[model samples]
Target: MKNISWIGIYPALLTPFTENDEIDYPLFQINLDAQIEAGVDGIIIGGSLGEASTITAEEKREFLKYCVKTLEGKKTPVIINVAEQSTKVAIAMALEAEELGADGIMLLPPLKYKADDDEVVTYFKAVAAATKLPILIYNNPVDYGIRVTLAMFEELLPYANVQAVKESTRDLANITNMLNKFGDRFKILGGVDTISLESLMLGSHGLVAGLVDAFPRETVAMYKLVKAKRYDEAVAIYRWFMPLLELDIHPKLVQYIKLAATAEGIGSEHVRAPRLPLKGAERERVLKIINDAIANRVALPDYKNL
Candidate 1:
């Protein structure tokens, strides 16, 4: 694993699959290499964008092992999401990720179960104790049913490794509240794509981006432009890319993003079984947006090949 800053474009990865229902390692390597080439700060594995629900536990372990080996010499860190619904499984996965040499872990509140504030806090504490790696609480309350409320975070304060949060609450006011209540206590990374620019402007340290899985160069450019305080330049790209970035919120996000990635030559559009590839009108509509973006594209000197 590389030296992870936890404050930059750390794209949630989209796993590629073979028609035989196994991981396409060659295609997966292509995606990983592309992120490294495009200068991403880190890469997150087994995320929602990676189709984690459909991917098996064994596949996740293999993916983590492969990433730790492939990224051995690079400076990019590998962080995996552990979304198990049970605390026991979550702790086991967290320990395995650390053992596999992952730099950090992104954890969601127990999936499919509505955990109360105390249960959520206890779950976090147990997993935090099981591993020494940095833990990024995936706090997307809208999509995940369970909210990591301020009161819950108050309890998580004791665990030093649980300082960062992938803030997807979509409430900018909450961002202000977090900063006000416990300034710098959490390294908030904007998890939603459309509001990425706003989050950065509101003092987010970085973006745990989705569209960047395919449009890495543009994503990095936006982040760099914002960091440079060149709001105009960043907004210009954000305006052009917002349509595709919004795709991250759709139901078929994995397929949509894989297409965008393949269009950019970074990933394959082969999603796992439970999810089928987009076809007919839906396919054309998404392709039109992706192709048009490619056609009337930004003349980024560094991204022309992409």
Candidate 2:
């Protein structure tokens, strides 16, 4: 099995698009380079933050190939997300991701339909059985409406490839619950940016961060500080980051984050149809938050050196 350490920061990266609404390879590469330089432990592509619903399968494949080729031998593993509505399509995509050099998979419950516990477990098991690559189950019941409760994860214990989970249930207790019930059987990564420090402080292995797409250095520095037991310093940065981090939870997060990244000179705010760019007051409000954070951006310690 290809080894992908499910620890430290993993950005659920944004898919940069051109003015023509096509994948902007140049801009995407710029953002990917930013994430790499910030020292993210891993990268997740085609996630909800990546606007997976709007992205075509062919586009996803091309993006994955581009990322794989770009990240070649950099020691940064790229994990492709599988959020299909069909068992067959999910399995096929998982297999193709493996074939195309993805280091791992971030599997979500079937999209559009809320599968009951048994059905959801079955979906996960089927995909796990089909792929030898390591899997990080994307467990965001709050958004996806299909919660992978502890009982359901018990059903997945037999699959060695189902190695970790993106714990986005928005319930902090779930972190300790996973630690208490499963021990180290599954690596738990905090999936929400707002509660990331709390999650890490509670023993989550790492984070699948959202705002990190634009503020990668701050995200990485905060994680390193937390791990190094520098609580005060980490809290200082998290406090400054909270306002901008709040952008990840909103419905227009793609636009909000894309705009933030654009402000940081890494990306553009062009999203696919049905999700237009922020306009009027909404744009100003989000820009104010981003600008305030930038103006008050904390001088990070030598977290990388530490």
Top of the candidates by lDDT: 2
> lDDT tens string, model 2, 1-306?
899889999999999999898999999889888888888999999998899999999999999999999889889999999989999999999999999999999999999998899999999999999999999999987888888999999999999999999999999999999999999999999999999999999999999999999999999999999999999999999999999999999988899999999999999999999999999998999999999989988999988888
TM per candidate comes to 0.95, 0.99
Instruction: Determine the backbone clash count of candidate 2.
Output: 0
In model 2, where is the ten-residue run with the lowest total lDDT? 138-147
Expressed as tens digits, the lDDT of each residue in 95-213 for candidate 1 is 88988899999999998889888899999999998889899999998898888988888888988888689999999887888888889888889999989999999989899999998
Q: Candidate 1: where is the Cα deviation over 4 Å?
A: 1-3, 301-306
Clashes of each: 0, 0
Candidate 1, position 160, lDDT? 84
